[model samples]
Target chain A: MRVRAQMSMLFHLDKCIGCHTCSVACKNLWTDRRGAEYMWWNNVETRPGTGYPTGWEDQDHYEGGWKPDGDGITLRLQGKGKALARLFFNPALPQLEDYYEPFTHRYEDLFDAPAGDVQPTAVPISMVTGEPMNVDGGPNWDDDLGGSDIFARNDVALDGVDQTIRAQMEEIERVVFNYLPRICNHCLNPACVAACPSGAIYKRGEDGVVLVDENQCRAWRMCVAACPYKKVYYNWSTGKSEKCILCFPRMETGQAPACAHSCVGRIRYMGVLLYDADRIPEAAAVSDAELVDAQLDMILDPNDPVVIAAAHEAGIGDDWLDAARRSPLWKFVKEWGLALPLHPEFRTLAMMFYIPPLSPLVASVERELYRLELPPERQDFELFDRLDKARLPIRYLANLFSVGDEQVIERVLRRMLAVRVYKRRQSVEGVVDDATKDLLASVDMTPEEAEAIYALTTLPTVDERFVLPPYHREMSIETLNDPLAHKGEVGVGYLEPPRRGW
Target chain B: MSDTVAMIVFVAFPYAALTLAIVVTVLRWKLAPFTVSSISSQLLESRKLFWGSIPFHWGIVLILLGHLATLFFPATVAWWNGVPIRLYALEITGLALALWAAAGLLVLLYRRLTTARIRAVTTPMDLVVLIVLAVQIASGIWMAVGYRFGSFWSVGVVVPYVWSLLKLSPRPELLQPFPFILQLHVVSFFVLVAIFPFTRLVHLITLPLPYLARPWQRVVRMRHIEPVG
Candidate 1:
């Protein structure tokens, strides 16, 4: 089993508050440059909306990600021959308009303006051309469903649902949405690395961090088109594609990435997952129905003796193996089966997993009518059978996280609900009654496991959440050479400092 | 004095240009490798680029191949031109290709000049390269129209001279009889070759041709490359 250590992430969507602290932190670190104002390396997208770059999930228009040809998958953008032919004019590329025209207020104008009856105003100016422009869209234009009528109605996930159900989603009170804060998945089979004509992009084997060699990036912009999540962005000033480096510098020293570390909601979990490298093709090639299972099967149990032996043979150290065993991502994604990859149908085998957010329970007409007939004093637990009527449709979450596997979404949400109900009963009711037991039994979870899930979800320490593996390269460097050898030269400087032009 | 100038332009200058091109290209590749890209402006303005780049690339590529064919198979080209109608067809085709290339070059130049974003991103080298390209294309079109049947006469005269240069025997006098426009084409070409590695023209050698045959997914194996202590 060619075991390889993959550093992965799990986002517990249940806890995310949609505050965009991660977005601002990442922007300040990576993409806050002249040409990169349009790029959001980390963005919190409000789902049930069309996301950044307008209707990105519609593969027919944007054509990002991989397409299943027969058994194997090919990039949905274009094949090799077609790609080379269209190198000059990448028809699939998202234009500046597709992403919003980045603009900033001319704040200096407020102070510069002469005193007048009207208050001094900072005119919005396009960052690209420095011309006055109307602010039409932004990186998070649909935040909290600000422009829900147009943005939410056009979401690609809603396409497969019943027309009436789709219409119901647009209704004011019936609406449901969740925050999907995204960074690049840094997939096992990254289409960006495959599509790069310059062969500049590479996934570092040591930690599986995807990086773009800016010098070699010929501004082909193929990576921008190929990434299914649209995480790779083109910097027009430098004429190159730039993406999230996953904070490898911080990670090497056992610190969480800036975004994860700065998270206010504590939704992000970083960890190591030991996987069978040989099964990547098989896992990614599976049918959409089996995608979640295939990906899980690919993630070898770190505790397994056989897997540990294979990992050792693959040059992995004991520290990394230990980290993998202790990984919160493994428990959330595989052991507990709470987190699932976003859009596994993309066939990129996205390393980032997410726990589908639980929505408020819908009180159906029958349930409410039945409640009215009975006395208020007799009402006790109304949780189990009512799960099928969650305000957010099972089909919608399935479309996003599980590729239309409604059963998968139902089970995850059921488990989450059981934990809450189980915990509330202990704290509020002061006992573990049979009603709570029946609720836990119906979802097939023990009280101990529910308690463990609850502890990790609500009360995890920073160390428990981010299980960073040992950097073998850094360790070797420290032992073989002096850590302070490069001293000032290596501390701060861009290898190839970006400039305007020749 | 004219004989000396001809020798410098035809024999000495061409050799010097080729040597400079080769040495500088290697040095730049080793030093500032990131600069070796045909950085696109399609992100800013793709509509004008489609009109400019497609015709320019396809037309120039075909025309360049045509130039190479005439030089390599001068005897075969002369034999084909022996027929009167065949000669006219060949001449008309060369002129048409030249016109097509020139038109594309004009569109590309105009786009760069007119577009605000494109003008901002453009470098001194970029403007110089475009102007140089314009001169070469304009001179070629001028020669094709003003001095007709260049494809026929060039085989007998220019072919032998160029062949002698390749054979390491200087024959600057043979090209001396050519008009100023014809000489300008040769001079502009060598200058382009000299400045090639510094401009976006380096991307000509950097196209990922292997991508057409390689697998869809690429996983870099850096394990073996690094020295493990």
Candidate 2:
């Protein structure tokens, strides 16, 4: 077993409250620069809405990620021969309009204007052109407009849902939505790495954080096309591609990434996960339906004795293993099987997993008196059975997460329901209902499991949410340079500011 | 016009170009490893580039490979040229490749000039390089056309002159008698070599040779030692 440790993240979707605090923190820390103004490295996208860069999940248009070719998977963009041939021009790249033109208010107009009946307002100016312009779009243009037909109706994830379900979702009174906060997944099988002709982008070995060596990036933008998540951004000013570095500088100092640290909903969980390095291709090569399970199978159990021995043999330290054992991601993803990777059919084997959101059941409208109807057969059933009646169809969640496997989404939603019911019973005055007990039993869950899930999801402290492994910077630095020589310096910065061109 | 100038141009200049190419390329690799890439503008304009790039790269690659073979393996070239049919075939193939390269370069030059996005990124050096390359190829085609039996003649004349330089013996006399265009082609070739390390031409050296054999995903650890698995 060629075991390797990958730093993984789990975002508990049920707990997310749709605040853009994480987005602001990430922007202020990283991408608030000349060419990167439009980039939100941690944008909170409202689900059932067209995402930033609009319709990024429309693979037919973007042609990002990997697809099975014969026996193995190849990049959806181009193969080696085609890559060399089209080395001069990539047709699939997104334009500035696709992602909105970054703009700032022209405050000088407000200050310099003469007094008149109409008040002088700050006009929006294009950051690129430095000219007065109307604000046509933004990074989060669809934020909280979940019921809008223009934004939410165009969501590609709903393509697989039945016409009835889609119609139901469009009902004005029954409109429901959830937040989907995204960052670079730092994938195990990153298509960006494979598509980079320059060999500039790479996944770090010490931790699995993927980074673009900006100096090496020739701005091919193949990484942009190859990434199904559309996380990679190109800096027009610097002439290089950039991406989420996963806050490695902060991580090395044992701090959570800015997005995770500043998250208002406390939905993000960070931790170490050990996996067999040799099985990456094997996992990615599986059929689309089997992709989620195959990827999960590749993540070795941290507490397994066999895995522990292999990890030790692979030179993983005790502290890292301990961190892995305490990982909330381990509980959510592997042990409980509650979380699923987004667009596993992309076949990049993304490291970030999300627990499918459980949108509340749509209330029936009757002569202006809205009421939730528990079906006659399910009247005796527990609240968990109401998952089938949720406003957001399980098929839509399945299409987003499980490559159209509704069973996986159903199981996760059921587990989430079980935990909520179990928690409600404990907090309220009533004893646990027999129907609730039967519901838990049907899903192969116990009261203890539900309680444990509740504690981690609802009541987790900061320490429990982010279990950071010790970053042995000294050991890593000694391999490439003298650690003592640079003892007092910060590890991650350029002495001079980066400029355009070579 | 004088012996000193001729010696510098023919002998001293070749050595200087070779040295500059090697030393500066090494320095750049050490100091600015990241900038050593082709800096492809593919994302900006693709349709016109698709037509302009493919033939240009293919034609140039064939021409370069043929040139390398003739330079390094004079005896093999001579043996092949001994037959009239083989000699005629080699001459035709070289001329065809040169013409193909010239055509491709013209398309590329047109695209570079006309495309707004490409023109924006086009530095003066980039234009100079393109013009110089076109001139070099045109001069080469001129020599091939004007001087019949150049495939056999160059084996005796240019090969020995190049070999003499590698052997550290100045033999400007061998090239001195050649036509001005042929001489200009040789001089411009060395000029390209001299400016190569400083330009995007440096990407030719960093062709990602290891990529073919490398695993799809690279797993680099801080430690050099292998795991005990």
Candidate 3:
């Protein structure tokens, strides 16, 4: 096995409140430059909405990500010959209009206004040209389903659901939505790396953080189109493409990423996963029905004696291995099988897993105000097997996470309900009920395993959730140069002029 | 006085252009690698670019190959032109491509002048390169029409003259019989080469030819790139 370590993340989406704190934190750190005003390296999206770049999931139009081509896979974007020919003008590239033209208010007018009867209003100006412009759209225009008619109705994933459920989804009384905060997936089979003509983008062998080497980028802009998530953004000022770096500089110093660290709802968890690098291709080449299981299979068990020895030989230190064993991502994604990747059909093998949000149960309203939800003390023992009766169709969640595998979504939801039942029975009744035990067994989970899931999900501290391995930056720095040697010298000096290369 | 002027234009100027092109291109690439680019204006106004760039590139590529053939393989091209039909075919094809290129360049120039976004990004150097290119094209078109069948005769005179330059033996007398337009074409060609590194034309040498043979996926490890699988 060609073992490699990957630092991954899991979002307990149920806990997310759609506050957009993580997005602001990431923007303040990385993409606050002049050209990057429109880029949100981390942005919270409302599910059932058409996302930031409208209809980005319509890969047929944008031509992003990979497709199953007979045995292996091929880029959905054209091959090499066509790519080189189109280098002069990439027809597939999203226009500045596809992503909204970033703007700022001319707030100076508010204070500079002469004494008048009316209060002065700030006029929005285009950030690109510094000219006055009408504000047409923004990064999160569809947040909280504000424009559900235009954006939510056009959601590409809705095509997978039955017509009846799809119709029911739009009804005001039956509407359902959730928050989906996104950053670069740092995919194992990254399409951005594959599409770059300059070979500027690469997946780091150290921790699998996909990075764009700014010095090597030739402004080809192919990566901007090829990423299925549309996470890569073109910087108009420097004439280069940029994306989320996962805050590698912070991570190397043993800290969580800005987005994860600043999550207000405590929904984000970060950790390392040891995976067999050799199996990446095989895992991605599987059929759509088997993709979720295939991806899960590639993540090697950290405590396995054989895997541990293989990782050791493959240059994984004991510290990283220990972190991998305690990885919350492992417990959430592999052990409990609760989280699944968003849209595995893209075949990028995206590493960011998400626990599908469990929405409120469908309401039975008679005459618009008859039903009342009882207090928590009332004895209730309803079966969670009625997945079909949830406010949101299971098919929609299936389409988002698995490739139309409703069974997978049902299993995860039932297990979560079972865990909650087991916890509540212990806390409120002060005794374990037989019904709760049967419910746990029905989901194929023992009480001890359920208790572990409950503890981690409900009451995990920051340190426990984010198990970071030491990057040993000091060792690498010393090998490259002596810090003390630079003390006698004035500033940095280049021994050789920089040249463009792979 | 005429001999001295011809020597400067034909002998001294060619060498100067060549030396400047090489030394300055290397320095520019070393000192500012980021400046080396096509500096494409397609993103600002793509419709005009598509209408202009494709035809211009194709026309220029074939015309360049024709020039190179006359320089290096004069005997072969001369032998092929022995038949009147073959000579006429080649001459007509060259004239059509020149016209096509000129039309595309006009469109491109109009777009750059008119488009607000493109004009914002335009530099004085960009304008100079365009004017230089226009001079070269206009001279060639003029020579092709005014001095008909010059290709059949240039093989005997220009080939030997170019060879003499490469051999370090200057020969300014051979181009004396040529018209002023023909001389203008030669001088303009050298001027284009002289400004190669300073302009967006640096992209000509930076073609991603390596991409054709290289693997799609890339993974880097420990400052050393792993062999693409």
Candidate 4:
């Protein structure tokens, strides 16, 4: 295997506020051309919802990644194979008409109001509905700063709730949901990489970012169907497919990704992760579940001489090496025990990590009211309503920290305001920066209070030598046990071996 | 334009596109081999796509040649020219092969639409080009099998038009009375031409020698610098 570099990203969902700034910034930069209107290199999705194209998360429909059974993994191709092929030999997946078509209105449809016509003019109505037209669904229908349903399903931490919490929910149906501020996970076993008949998609070695070549593209559009993330898009005018470049241009200059750089919640981290170049092929070849451990092993230990030597040999700078140490995976797999992959079953070796939120405020508030023998609903219900109306803080925090609780307002605010130190360049920046202390104070936390929470969680929490299931290690060559592989197809091919260092 | 002339230009455009596409593919292979990034492994994919596209295109050329013979050769002259029945049979068989070729092209297109590698490389214009080709082939087949308009005489104009193009004097009058199917085909054909040079379709004319001139095996300097974070 040749020594080509791979790039990857690790997103911290606990810190993302679902503002569309990143989406707008990306759209303004890359996809603003005519015919590129529908393309968005960076988009925010509301979890538990259908996502942008609708039903994007349903693997059965898209057939993106490999699903493991007993012996091996099966490649599902419901979106590709012969069954669907007969429909359009050069089939166009159902276009806008196949879904709900978007409509725009002509100037004639609106009434011509005079300059001083002030009778409280109402907005023009939709032609289809004859009622006020409202934006229904897109990439982020549920991203209104609240917990989306996706968070609710995946957060398994919240179990066996206390009676005091249940008592607070007596009058309301306290259903819990989650919101995942998703971006390209830059998988170890990228389905788009595997599905390319032309083998055009690749994961970079330096940062693990995935990218596409325009000149070599034959305009096949296969990656569109192969990516479960649906991040890849086709450019009609150019006759080629496009996707997030991972803002490599910005990264090279030592700036964060646009989404990460602009994150209001400060939940993102970017760094150069050094892995064994040799293990990539093996990692790509294994089942998705087994693939996770092979990937975790690739995380470079900064203090390891061999890893340090390999980084020097590979031409990576020390700044990047230092940044790699700060990654959440370095904490979850190497430091903390609680952190886990979002959907280990997908087997893409997704790099993003979430340190499940633990709402001390919510727990404290509920406990104090019960001790005083006061009704749970009477304590600052107005504040609760306002926070609940926004929805995201409650929904996302519940999913990350406390799952299945319907009453999320007070708990969510207390947790959000709990963050104190915002780390930048390995040096700590006070969470109550001059710009945000006012907003921080309103949540009832002093700058000192937020800093304390940051100090507790910043250190490594997971042990580096922690043993994972055998599936996480490199599969034995003799165990070439894929039942679904096309006859002689060997496993994924990797050129470089993992960097071995203490 | 007379059907004969229309057929010639239809056949020639492929030759032009094929020639230019071959040259571009070859030059890029040798000079800018690394210009095609490892992002999607396009070096390997470009080869497969090139081969699939070749058969589909060459098939169209052969099919169009047969169409020209039917339109231009006089029936009496064909008999005196010997083996009229055999020649007519060959023409019919060629038309069938053309339809089959179109279907094969559709298969290739479907692969692009559904596969991740090809799909990522695909532009909306690429799909539009495929859709246009599909429509053209469908309509041409309809016209060949007794689907008609007000007059067959208009087709004679297309023949003259083809001759004029070969002579560098495109005669629009020959195409004025052409049937709807033929007119629709002609108008779409021009639109495809105007956009051909600007698209990946340009590869069709640039890579006729395939890998002989393609430098897919070489490692070259990549164009994209690593993005800093």
Best by DockQ: 1
What candidate 3 gets wrong by more than 4 Å, as runs, is: A111-120, A370-383, A486-502, B41-43, B149-151, B223-229
Number of the top-ranking candidate, with TM-score as the measure:
1
User: What tens-digit string does per-residue lDDT give for candidate 2 at B1-229?
Assistant: 4577679888899999999999998987777766666766654456666777766777788988988899999899999999999999999998998887788889889988986656756777778778888988988899989988787888989888988998988798888867788788889999999988877788687565455555667555656223322
Q: Candidate 1, which segments miss by more than 4 Å at Cα?
A: A363-383, A476-482, A492-495, B79-91, B166-168, B221-229
True contacts kept of 3: 0.26
Rate residue B145 of model 2 by lDDT: 93
Chain A: TM-score in each candidate? 0.95, 0.96, 0.94, 0.59
lDDT of 3 by residue, A1-502 (tens): 9988899999999899999999999999988886688899998889898987878899989999999999999889878888888886778787777778889999999999999999999999888767788898888988888226788788888877888777777888777898989999999999999898888899988899999987667777889889999999877666677899999999999999999999989999999988998998999899999999999999999999999888877778888888899999989999998999999999999999999988766656878773434434422443375677777778888989989899999999989888887888899999987877888899899988998998898899999888898887766666677856744552567543332221
Model 1 fnat value:
0.48
What are the lDDT figures for the candidates, one per model? 0.84, 0.83, 0.84, 0.49
Q: By the lDDT metric, which is better: model 2 or model 4?
A: 2
DockQ order, best first, reads: 1, 3, 2, 4
Residue-level lDDT of model 1, residues A1-502, one tens digit each, is 8877778888999899999999999999988998999999899989889998788777888788888888788889988888898886888898888889889999999999998999999999988888888999999998988227888888888767777777777777567888998998989889899898778888877678899988778888899989888989999988888999899888977789999999999999999988888998888888878988998889899889998778788887788888899999989988888999999988888999999988765543574462222234323443345555566778889999999988898899888888988998899989989878998998889999999999999999999999997675544566656766744346477765676334
For chain B alone, what TM-score does every candidate structure achieve against the true structure? 0.92, 0.93, 0.94, 0.57
Clashing pairs in 1: A215-B34
Q: What fraction of native interface contacts is shared by candidate 4? A: 0.01
Q: Is the docking of candidate 2 incorrect, acceptable, medium or high quality?
A: acceptable
Per-residue lDDT of A337 in model 2 = 92
